[model samples]
Target: MKKMYLSVVFLLCGAVLHGQQTPSGKVFRAGAATSNITPKIGTSNNGGMQDITIRSIHDETLARGIVLDDGQTRLAIVVSDLCMISREVLDEAKRRASEVTKIPAANMMMSATHTHSGGTACPVFQSEPDKDYGKFLSARIADAVIRANHNLAPARIGWGVGSEPTQVFNRRWKMKPGTPIINPFGKEDRVKMNPGIGNPNLLEPAGPVDPGLPVVSVQTPAGRPIALLANYSLHYVGGNGPGEVSADYYGMFANRMQQMLGAEGQDPAFVTVMSNGTSGNINNIDFGGKAPDAVLPYEKMRAVANVVAAEAFKVYQNIKYQDWISLSSAQKEISLGVRKPAADELVRAKDIISKAKKPIMTSMEEVYAQETMAMKDYPDQVPLILQAFRIGDLAITAIPCEVFVEIGLDIKQRSPFKPTFSISLANGYNGYLPTPEHHKLGGYETWRAKSSYLEVDASTKITASLFELLDKLEAANH
Candidate 1:
């Protein structure tokens, strides 16, 4: 019949040029949200000790977000299970998600999966940040970036790198020299952190382990997978026993990666995030081969969240999706020099706080060396805030502290970008930064309390201000 109507009009014009939706060349937009932010159960569980007991939540500490807009640069990356979130709750959650997604609070990129049982989610040690749980964690991190900026669409981006490295090791060790410990700054350290695993004068692990995990996958141009951002290096696994309050192992790695990617019977929200790299010295013990009935405590947080949710579903089944690329974000503010305690170490910290008789100080390395000689001349500088993002060739770096895994593998071996990872405790809190040869190997992250008091060349000036703001966000959208 007329050559079958010209072969059905050439197969309907090749299905209208392959249904024209997304082949990815750049229009890039994405969205994601999550809220929860746990807390409530005698709060205050900043990694134990305030008499280690009252802390019972068990799971539900979130505030995840993802909102990228490449209609010419827009980025909002938040992830907070907690146990650190200060620069006043990450600049009041990027100024209330930049007052309802007007975006730009320095292109907002907050982080904190440093989950050592993240419960009373922030107001850290000596109080003053918990005015109604910091406005309910800055209104649920700006309601998860204004519900991921009202759900932007047309997405596709993927990046992957895996290596569980036998359940992340390197918790500090290195003993044998007349094996006599003391550490938590009671002094006598030759390196120690979980030093008891098969103690026989240990002699190893003084740092090294990037058992990688880098993942970044956001789909849905009809592929359906709204989010997945991962970056590991261990440093959170807690046993969930005594006083519970756990999100440890990052709430079993975003609820077993939303039941392995397909988000199962759906909607507990599908956006799994787990950033916390530079492991501040890595964790999830192996200590001389930890086994007594293998994996316990929330079953080793569901076996390390099912080996990082099966490597983010093998990096979202090897992403070949890309709708657009070329997005950028950069923010900086560096200034170190808060390493006080001189003047004969503040006269031996007021002669050990005049024999610490009470203010409840039975040792936290003598009340953080009397809180580093009572904040010697008060906050004389430590202001940090470094961020850089440029998805599509993926490189995200943001450091606030607890950093270490060899400065996140030396900024991913001098990042000129190539799946470069690094998201350590983002926004603020500069406790341990180590490395000046691990502060001459003193251990407990180079004691001097007030939480590993910075400035031992604060890791070469925050690794040269995050490689000069990652070469100015790689010479931005040009």
Candidate 2:
């Protein structure tokens, strides 16, 4: 009887020591991992009106993820280096990851970094995705989550906010009256996108910029950094060499964060993720300001990365890491009307394409003409996935579109959680999400194309759904 009792006690101790629990009654753990997602040379790259064939690689792209388990609940957040990812691809990734880690498919939040030079993963304008590359990307994203789950250990988590206002500028401008602002559809517009730098015709920016840089840091019990996920509202800094594949500034920011935090040479390498925020109408250029001097191929992006990373490092110094934090996720699919072209517009599109001289579309009119025909076959309504995750007092919302800065600002202002930030281009890629007011202003982002075909009220509906999820999360926490 004495021997049997001793054996039972030993078994119980072993169970607790083998990652089932920490010394404390509740175990809050986190793990982070990265999966290389760099596409092969000669693969298609998106982010321009025309597709680019990759000729050289400037840097490796990655899908960096972090898994957090708070005794009862588990949540995974992943950020990938790509222009945009489709719903089907992300859904498959979530399914594969769930099968391995037993984390509910809804509990994982995955988003693209919106790097213009990264591998093409979704069709935008004339750029089409490479089907094989999409499949490979899905598998790698799932692998990232599985690996992170396997590495879970007792960890600390905290969040802080930083601001770098100098880098972000609203790219849409209200041109002087009678300035020829013809859109692809040959309609006049009040605002123009990327209107020349220091052009006297420029009046002012049509929208405001969001300069918030929110950082979420995870670390081991011994204070070794596990991962740091940062969100910024600046669109990609695009100065890469022609036909060169890169993760753009997103990957650069990750590397800089790792170096600045002194997280080099650890047993498990430190992973840093820079997720795109609401930057659909934001860019690094100042349209109304003086044009910057000519820069080397990757110089501009590196400069932007350093500046943003420096701001993040400042916020990192003041983070208050907590040993235990509640984690919860809620997901919902909402259907919104698609702004398909009307009968007259479709006819005009077909006419334009039929009369085009070049075999491939080279003019703006030809590109948008092709887009109009594609939109004609789209369903009247399409479902979109909206997700919200709660990490202690911090809230992170994910939307499957290139969101506008105003929407993000409104969410932060109204969210029940303090210092809330959103990840755009998440789970799927729809198109640019401009507000109804902006839509009325008739800018490039509002033109009817696959790249901007969301209904006028899509932003309103999305925010309503997100608030519902966020409110539920907050109530449950209290």
Candidate 3:
């Protein structure tokens, strides 16, 4: 009888210790709203034309850190409200943050919101000069990291995927036999036939659309929601008419979420961060068929933001927290072939340059022009960085540019983990990475120009590299 009692006691103690060994997470919110950067109004046909001004909005970074009781490993998810995150800059930030927090560099996953209306834009291609916007951006980003690290406390995390179809539309249009191609911006006077319409049978409707909106919520030990991170691929097009830099629709969406779950509302202590997914060819506006009579107003943009926020909250309400925690990460370098201008293509480019209407010259235009001239003298190769992180059941794969929906879906379909999300414009901006099909279609996204200098094969090679990283992560975990 004594031996049996001792054995039972030992079994109970083992169960209790195992249960207590689960890792805990914490949520931190930091924001810097002032970006001295202002848009160069009226520079292009797409430049600001309406009287929209940003008085005040939320431009935030949310960082979530997960640490095991043993402290052997730490993982963090840092989301920023910006157009892009350069690998060099992000590496420096990671080095600094890791030095301070002791978190491994590979364990840090940093991503951007891809907000076009945000602070000074980074260089998209080698043809574009690197903007000095980092002077103001670096300090703000570092402050966010410090604040997030300071707010670490015990928490529980839950994740779910919600669908919102009406909010996103395919911006690229396919050419069909006898199908009229309308102007993208809806000005009937601007309607013109697609210049490359000879091979009509080969062209198809724009790329695939990803309407999945994944929400990840972290709550305090006491059950108060501390932070919510939502991922989607739609490009931020709500602030076409802008002023001083702002976070565009991403800010609006966060505001709506705060109001819905804040103290005065549902009273959840929720801090929301909107992360951009593979949205190279995705937008809120449908560029196909007939164009609208007028541009989408700010009010319409706000409405769209609210709808997305509401759908995200719906997913948040249905989450179930898990206790199993495991972390893994991998990074790889990929080479994308250079798209050198052929002799004939150079002649054609010169012809277009001679006839194309030039906009008013500003300091910004002069800088861009100088960069364009320099690019003509050289051929450049784009380096793609693929990074992946696993936090329990949630897996994050980071790609360096605006990726097409098909590529995003392909990654998700092949991922060994559930609820996988691809964060785009993360760690770098190498322009749009369209699939082979979209590359053949030859639209604004796939066109190789001064601003978009990457070759079409770059997208394919990067996609393959990311999949290989995913496989390695799965193998390590098992």
Candidate 4:
């Protein structure tokens, strides 16, 4: 009897150390909220080669977030409306939230929506971030998490993936032989980005498009919706008026989803988040088709949002909501080399800038010359945060770059979870992540600019690290 008692005691202690709470009485809970992060007029906006000042506010930008607690472990997922946010800004936001909620910073995964008209938070090309706006943005992001945590209630969660093939197309195309495709670096490019519609010289697309729309929905035990988080690989659909600040299609999708699900006017207000997926090489333009009819400002984005939200609503109805499931998150920081300019490249860049007609670049050649000079001042290496989350049988991986669709597809194929999807521009911004083969083809995405300055092998390293993290989560959950 004494020996049996000792064995039982040891087993109970081990269970406690592993954080296995008693299953019979535990409950799964969730909460979601949004915090507006829209900038005032005259604030700097990103997503263009040159800096832009916001002349108007067409729509409000937001930092939408969800918090999930599986009776033991907690996880937070946030999507912000901005072109790109640096690692420094996200880290600060995480720290602030962690202080309030007691959740480790690593357990939170945050990403940007890649909205072209949102407030600037990272310097890309010539658009510099407004330092005050960055500070305000961080606080607002943290507030989103804090408010969501405060609203936690008993909930059920489910996930499913649907397809919207008609909306996504590979934007990079291979031109016919000897096509005059000149890059900003005075070199010939085999592929052209957004090659004009109906161009006979276009041979074929250079990459593949991912049409998967993965969604995770949470609701009260009695069936009232709490939040819906959806991921799609198509880049932002931009049709906002010039100098107008908007969340692009992301915000539109959120609003459309609320209406479709009849989630409006709820006590806590339903939150819907449309996160950008792996779309560095994907877009909505149909290059092989006829010229599209020009639409008024915000019209194109609204139409696209309706299509995506309709698909999401169709998928949302069929998901099998689980009353209780496990949640786990794993994060890692990896260092990558920066693709700095070569000695000869710097000399050429200086010469090009000296001969420019004006200080403000008017041509691609001049703009890239300045980018080359700026690359000289960057550090030899930088760190990126990679994260993965497991909710029941579904898996979500987060990469800090504008990840290519091929990489996302490869991860989905190899992941231990069945319905795995990737969220791009997550945790931080690290520029465009192209495959090594794409780098060799030398398209605009692989140009030697701040927007694409990671070493050629950065994607390989990031994917490998993510697999390790996913494996860790799988083992722990099992």
lDDT of each: 0.75, 0.91, 0.61, 0.91
- The residue pairs found clashing in candidate 2 are none
Cα lDDT tens digits for candidate 1, 258-297: 7776584544256878888888887877787755575556
Candidate 3's clash total is 0
**In model 4, how large is the Cα lDDT of residue 273?**
93
TM-score of candidate 2 on Cα atoms, chains taken together = 0.96
Which tens-of-lDDT digit does each residue in 364-400 have in candidate 2? 9999999999998899999999999999989999999
Q: Estimate each model's TM-score.
A: 0.34, 0.96, 0.76, 0.95
For candidate 3, give the lDDT: 0.61
Lowest-sum lDDT 10-residue window in model 1: 16-25
Q: What is the lDDT of residue 211 in candidate 1?
A: 85
Off by more than 4 A, model 3? 1-70, 124-132, 178-204, 263-269, 287-297, 347-374, 377-379
Model 3, position 314: C-alpha lDDT score: 93
Question: In terms of TM-score, which candidate is stronger, 1 or 4?
Answer: 4
Error of 4 at 242 (Å): 1.0
The model with the greatest TM-score is 2
Candidates ranked, most accurate by TM-score first: 2, 4, 3, 1
Clashing pairs in 3: none
